[model samples]
Target: MIPSLRLLYWRPSAAALVRTRALLPMAEFYNHETGDGAFRLIQKSDYARALQGARVGLCLSDHEGPMRASVEYQLLDLPVVTTEAQGGRIEMMDPAHCRVVPADPRAVADAVQELAAEEIPAGAVRASVLSRLAAHRAALPGLIRPHLQAAFDDASAGVTLDDIGKVDLWRTRDAEVIRREVDAMPV
Candidate 1:
């Protein structure tokens, strides 16, 4: 029996648009198509649930992201076949974890076929997710510290106006006059 090789994506475009018919008999194309068809859009909440008992998660895009669904699949320990154009800061499905292939339907088909024939090692899939999580976990502080400091400084110190040269005098004076007049006016 062929294992479940499902495409979990937010939108269908590019090769996905074409592969719907190309991979129709084999791949279960999911995501927003109705009327007596195997392909159907699953709600975001139900993504992980829908992936239950699935073997492969396929995403074939010229420009793909390090997607949440892909990560979820990784967390669920499912093999993935995706293009290089994924969005995440880190490659969640590294070469060790999943099949990274050319952004073409045939290549995607081959990867899916390979995954279906051979079971994806649970350790590898989990480790890929864990590795990405660990890297992000380790880097979280560094990633946030600089931005937080910049924000803190901006909030606390603000943009100083010593000479007031940068300020548009008309707008500034208008605001100042309004404030002074409001303050000086009878309560």
Candidate 2:
């Protein structure tokens, strides 16, 4: 049986068209275009409902920050086929539930086929996201504490309000200054 696929396009950009064209020959293409301008926005509930019968979610973007849609796909119990350059998504997904492939369309097609043949439990996929979220929450304070301390120390230092007024905020807030401050913090 042919596996069901759901392609979620947030904006009607050239990128979306490229992805759709790449996958069209591999499977039957369906167009559900709505809305106007570049955006084809859908409600979260509607998106989730649309994913109900999908066997896999495809994220074919060349780059992504966190790949929020892929995470949503996992939450809705759909396996994800994403690109490796998808930022935090690589770290968020478990290998069992997510396939990180190259940007090549063939690679994406192969991953989809592989995932379609296997049975991935929905609860396990959702649990992977929850576990990552819990770990991130637990570690957030530690990651942020040093920066907060550095900012506090800077505020209390010999620099007076008058001196602060004279100083260029942009230059003072450069990456090198921040890096030096972070590096100086005690482990």
Instruction: Write model 2 residue lDDT over 1-187, tens digit each, in one string.
Output: 2345445565555776777668564552333444432345567677776667787888777777777877887787777888878357777788987898997867888898998778776488888888887887666545545454476654534543334357643355678877786578654
The 0-to-1 C-alpha lDDT of every candidate, in the order given, reads: 0.62, 0.69
- TM-score for all models, in order of appearance: 0.59, 0.67
For model 1, residues 80-132, the per-residue Cα lDDT tens digits are 78766746623666765478788776788788778866855657887778877
Residue runs of model 2 more than 4 Å from their true location after superposition: 1-5, 14-39, 152-187
Candidate 2 accuracy as lDDT: 0.69
TM-score of 2: 0.67
Regions of model 1 farther than 4 Å from truth: 1-8, 11-41, 153-187
- Candidate 1 lDDT (Cα, 0 to 1): 0.62
